[model samples]
Target: MKQQTKTSKNPWVWIPTLYFAEGIPYVIVMTVSVIMYKRFGLSNTDIALYTSWLYLPWVIKPFWSPFVDILKTKRWWIVLMQLFIGAGLAGIALTLPTPFYFKASLAFFWLLAFSSATHDIAADGFYMLALDDSQQSFFVGIRSTFYRLAMITGQGLLIILAGALEIMTGSDPMYVNVTTSPTEQVDYNFENIPEDLSNIDELTFVVYPKNVTINTNKISTDSLSSLKEFAREHNTKNGFIALSETEKLKKNRLDGGETWWSHNISTPLANAIVKNFGVKKEVITKTTDDKVGNAKLVAVRLNKQPEEDKEIVLNTGFAKGDKSISIGSGERLVFNSMNWNVPAYILVQLDPKLEGVTSASFKGISGNIPLAWSITFFIMAGFFILIFVYHRFVLPRPASDHGSAANSPSDILHEFGITFVSFFKKRGIFIAILFMLLYRLGEALLVKLSSPFLLDIKEFGGLGLTTGEVGFVYGTVGVISLTVGGILGGIAVNKKGLKYWLWPMVLAITLPNLAYLYLSTYMPESMILINTAVALEQFGYGFGFTAYMMYMIYFSEGKHKTAHYAICTGFMALGMMLPGMVAGWIQELIGYQHFFILVILCAIPTFLVIPFLKVDPDFGKKDK
Candidate 1:
């Protein structure tokens, strides 16, 4: 009997895992990181800006894809890049808890991103090398299904897991409360105080001269004293006291009470403390003396802790008669109060901008990520380890002229040049590239901001969904709808041909975006409504995107078809990157409702450009 070739090994064992591996890091780097940054309290602008840059490798992967075929065997590149990806993921986990995590994690993310892109090239090339054309066509659907399952794993399950971890590991911030003793007659003063209060331990009160003007433009102390008196008399009657700075003005109230001024007084007080004392400052006040007999200064101090410590101390001054605040160990008080109202407490995040005062908590919106992150990373690393092992042992190598490409770099460079030149030489190539970019413009913008919109407050025109809910809607329900739509689209195209189905596919993609418009407009909290809308939109996107993809394949039918298709995808990435980078900024500018409307308007180009493109009448028909 003839010896069995390694290439004869079952494609089933490797194809699923190969595509699954290909997808996880891409989703993590692209979509998951966006959600992570949002939770980390990064502004939408920054989240869009930094995370959008991660698409760079994919956008330029075609340039390097030719080299993967030239340099080493596809199997070698796939396994090696997978190893690098695993290491990069572990690196992200290691750096997540550090003070410089944003920088460090992003660096690792960049590494993982590049490696994942290379793996795409290698794994895809390897698939072609190992399988005959018939097998290639046969396993395509299996590979795609597995790839999408990876999407649900990363986008849905991992997100839900992270959200659950957040709830499980999350703790309420420890606030420092200042309570007044009925017997003690505490005097009020605001004068020169040391900037660095981190050294002071226990309750140490620093009294300043009462009614002495803050004497600087930074803080109008005269106005603040008047506001304090006004708040004591008005209580909850004044609307300004109940609103945040942004809300107060929008309510159309003519009275600019002390409540309005005092709500924003913390920033100036912080500035004054920083300027005069050369240290960071926190301003916690009792604007309303409601239940508290009289306003008194109760000074609480912060003890010195290790530099790496992440304990948060809030200087929260509440009015008298409120419940006592509780805190965890390692947490110290700087001051305390009960029944605290808006403008009543001004807690400034002081930056001691000095060498001795490194104790300021950098606790952002998400505060600190739970220790559970390490576990999540380890699990990911384990998955990669298993993948690496399976591929090394079970995968068969393909015979090729690998040594020729490996030895001669110049030949690879020459082929890349020819590949680029020949791609543009195709008929209607300009229009083909135009359609590639425009077809998905609206979808590109939508994908970038969709998660942010879901997590945003309903008042801001978003769905106000939790991270886990978003994962559920997008990952499970939405992805399934997408897959079903894609399958149906393929079947339909096979029966009627792409030309006959083109318009319907276009409608499928563009019209479903209105689901977002409806959600943004209505701001429904119901999961059923949200899921249905998301599923509908995703199904449309999947169906429409099939046409876009098929058109690329159809357009890239001549010589150098592979390289030309790669170039087309490069434009596709570019289309997503350019809009995604700006979508958040645009959403921030226009709010979610208008942003969704804008997305709908963006689809106009897709409709307008259909006439300019060429499609084979029987391209996708079975008889063809």
Candidate 2:
């Protein structure tokens, strides 16, 4: 008779809880780190460098995994790690400041990474201890499905939530315009201004100055009069005039060869003239030829210095004042008061070089309907496609049926023991670890150095993307491309053996890094180019990463396969961390362009790993 065996009362009970614990902390640390850095106003290089340090706990987790196995039960480790992660997240939320939320958030993320790494070790070990070979075989699919769902929840849902919060609160966009000089000049051209203002009824004028002062009648007039009289004796026409309507005499008078007085007086001495004079007019004429027949004539009073041979023409639009005067050809009007009437539009023409001056319209996202809708539709369609592929193709296949051999309690234990011992003995295990360590070196370097290089206004190292724009490109477009690349890579690997596709994977990965080189070199002002470059690089990374995972699986063969794979992942984390720690310092030393070149140079070691990898002959073969 067959031996009676005790089984889990409910196999699926722990699925959601375990996966949720696994996913949240990992996503918060690994994926959201980029967003946090961007929010904190760090350059790409700085963010990459700093956050990459967070990978340290993950990289060294393998060294600790064995101890977990030897020491207390897996359940204890899992529960404890989960609690730790929750605490870390809560701590981060508490520490986050209104101003520096991103940096504080990242601090908590690092804590989460540490906790999550420990959780991963215990959870994986617990799976082995809890399930027999047959149950393990059947349930592995369930576990992976939940794990993927967790990734989607963490990366997709959480990231989207963060983005929505960023947009609503204006947190990301706040850092865009950096503090610089008090006045940052941007050129504007008045090309659309009507050239011919020949015909019109009432011309309204408004004048504004770069700097303005309001001289209220606050000071005593006697003191001002005495100072002005003294200045006039010194040939300086500066003084205050005080006269009531009854005290002032209105008549045609000339003092400086220009029109000095007018007969028609609206208010006595209200508009008085002193010495300097100028005139500008917007004339309306009745022309039978065209419906909009009108012109604006701008007149000027040429002020010539008597002692010097220089002539300075002070135009009607020169000193800020407004007047509506009707003038025929060669008609002249004079004012006795010092107040000169200038047209409003002449303010922009004061300096010949100041040609560009125009107000900009604020049309929101909805204004660009087609482009916005196109992007929205594309993103939605991509997500749907992913859902379909994941559910229809990837979900149905069980690990045991697809090259995983251990299928019963005895088989799992035997395999585990053999693999566990082989992990210490085999040269391949060490090599695999080394390969994982080297795999992400280039990516790490790129992240660590790209921002400082691009933002170096002094030197040519970066594209100088705005904070919001960079977030859009990297967080949104980059994420999409990464998803697509991962999906494609998975499909490719599943269809063709990793050995046959090694060179293509290498090329795909390395070539995309070159996009960064190009982008860093020609830091384009256009948002489209920036988004495209980010997408391409991320897509390549996604594709290459799929190959890396497959290689780990291939290397983790024989006994204790899951443990070996976990060990490899630790090295992978290390590869990211080591480069990140030194990225900022290196960027400061070598600069951005050269640093990116160095990133490219690091790829050589990654490609070198490809030659040593042995592809499984029956890589994609199904078990009968």
Best by TM-score: 1
Instruction: Report the backbone clash tally of model 1.
Output: 10
Per-candidate clash tally: 10, 29
Q: Supply the TM-score for candidate 2.
A: 0.54
Report the error of model 2 at residue 317, Å.
Answer: 33
lDDT of 1 by residue, 1-624 (tens): 323245578888889999999999999999888887665545576688778888889899898887787676788888899899889888988887666778998999999999999999888878887787788889999999899999999889988887766655543323333332323333444233334545555322222221111111122334344444454334223221222222333343456443645546633443343344331221323223211112222222222232343422222221222222111111112111221111222222111111121112212112234354555676787889888878888877666414344457676777778988888888888888778888998988898888988876433345556668888988899889998999989998999999999999999999999999899877665679989999999999989888988898898888788888888888889888888887776666556777788899988998888988789898999999
What is the lDDT, from 0 to 100, of the residue 420 in candidate 1?
89
Q: Give the per-residue lDDT of model 2 (tens digit) for 1-624.
A: 212123323456665456655765676576555554443334454566667778888877766665566556566566566656656655565545324455665677777788888888777766665555777789876786566565565545554554444334321110001111213433323343344343433221111222222111122334333433343222212111122121233322323222334345422223432111111122222224322211122222212111122111111211112111111121111211242232112111111111222221110110111122223223433443343243232222122211223255576566556755777686665567667878777887776554344333322244543334444565567767877897788778777767666778777777788877777667565668867877898899889888788888777776667678877777777777877876654554344555667788888887777677666755742320
lDDT at 499 for candidate 1? 92
